[model samples]
Target: MELKKRIEKFKTREFETNKEFYLGIEKGQNPHTLFIGCSDSRVNAEILFQARAGELFQIRNVANIVPRDDDPDNNLSVVSALEYAVKVLKVKNIIVCGHSNCGGCAAIRKLNDYKDDLPNTAEWISQSSRISDYIDGKYPDMNEDNKLVLLEKLNAVRQLDNLLTYDFIRQAFDSRKLNLQAYYYDIGTGDISIYDYENEFSDLIKEIALS
Candidate 1:
């Protein structure tokens, strides 16, 4: 297709224009922080964090899941990356960031809609069914924006709990060698909110803020 061909040509041109910029990344990257976030194009952690190349080691997944340890095939890649970042790279911080209006989070709301066709996704999203219920009851009378905000907060906590199932994460936490943080990005306002582990379902809109 002409559109696909144009994209390839644009990529080549971009590389030629930014050759040195990309080449600096050739030797290696030693990011201080590990960012685990969504695969959503709009929720780019680099852009949100104002992180330049080599400043962030980013791990992205559907629904921003850091699955339990028992899931070898799924958890292996994340675990490997985590181990490399923590043990080898010795990164000081790891952040799990979810976002508002997530299709994955919204899927829990319409589980029955995909009940017959999307078996795997249904099961996968069921991890946050409690999130669905929480959002459901919290914002039943609120607007769509409010409902999405509620889901965003709940998703962060749920994913953080999922991360705790990993031995490496718990070890890191227990040893106080690393700080694990949960966050949510509001695409509508281009704002980030960090999770306060103490205050359930509350976003640290001010204290954990970044420009």
Candidate 2:
């Protein structure tokens, strides 16, 4: 019911029934995947993937954005986490997942509308400040709703592109030790579309099957 109650329940369950799993995680986390997802409350990466503890190294940020390596001030925490996950943790795969009706993406569509109170948030999503210009020029005939949907998907691809900027990630990828994926989740329909950097989005499929 209440947040505290839920936490207490988890504590009891952890020591009572899930003790072994918790104990194993306490020893060390050896997550096989790195999940970069949105800060949206409804988008829980572990729940969506049905992942257990220590299975994923997760980072949540506005719209699942991955700041370019050249931009140090944009998202330093993300960069640090990524470096740890790749260079130290040696996570084999990384996923940048975006979701439908994302408030961050919506804010991108209307950056100028924010008040002074949201200065930090506005600055954080500066990567999408000029998104309107792109959408207008690229899809002049597309409506607002469709444009936002396209923007969300494009942002996912953009994050994957950003991941390539990191030297460790690039080296791992080149050596076939690491893989990257872009995913778009439709909150309304509960469908997730995976994007290949080269082609369009499609239903979930094995990475090796993509061409």
Candidate 3:
């Protein structure tokens, strides 16, 4: 089917089925959480969270990176959305979610493979190379598959850390007005690993809460 047909189908089918939901959306959006995630087609933040309309303010990017607030030359969209969500929307929770089989993380593992041809993508993903450093320093013996998994989890943590670089976020966190979390999602098995900044990744609790 064509894009317009798909949209019309949604308007008549899904939207018609959820008339009240769209009515509330039409009134205004007052999302309670900010979901920062990768732009991968398979990772739909709203679907994964089973979120209703206006429940989540979402920002999706190449690698789900949170560039440092001081990095004025990069990630203006993310920064703007974040400011609006936190400052204007007053979202109480912020989650940085990374996924398995992420092409962006894979590019980091094989940086040389894409650096020459896909320079822009390489530059964007390279911002999260701290995950590579963690892999090197902490899990040097891990196999390629395990390494990618570790990278996926670590990238979420790194982005969470980056979130604190913003003074507003730091203030919100410090005052206990907002919560920050990191999550690693397995696309194949639908498993989600939560990251606790206080402990090593292995020590954190892993859950299989698909519903």
User: Which 10-residue window in model 1 sums to the lowest lDDT?
Assistant: 202-211
> Per-residue CA lDDT of candidate 3, range 133-199, in tens?
6577666787889988877887887777678889999999889899888888999999988775556
RMSD (Å) per prediction: 5.7, 5.0, 5.5
Best by lDDT: 3
- Candidate 1 whole-model C-alpha lDDT, 0 to 1: 0.73
lDDT of 1 by residue, 1-211 (tens): 6999888986799767888988988898788898988778888877878877788887886677766666544657777887788778878788888887888777777788877898887777766666666556645787766776666676776666666667777788779887778888878888788874446543432222211
lDDT of 2 at 171: 95
Question: What C-alpha lDDT values do all the predictions have?
Answer: 0.73, 0.81, 0.83
Which ranges of candidate 2 are over 4 A from the true structure? 72-74, 201-211
Model 2: per-residue lDDT, tens digit, 167-211?
A: 889999889899888889998999999886556633211121231
Model 3 root-mean-square deviation: 5.5
Candidate 3 regions off by >4 Å? 200-211
Candidate 1 vs 2: which has more lDDT: 2
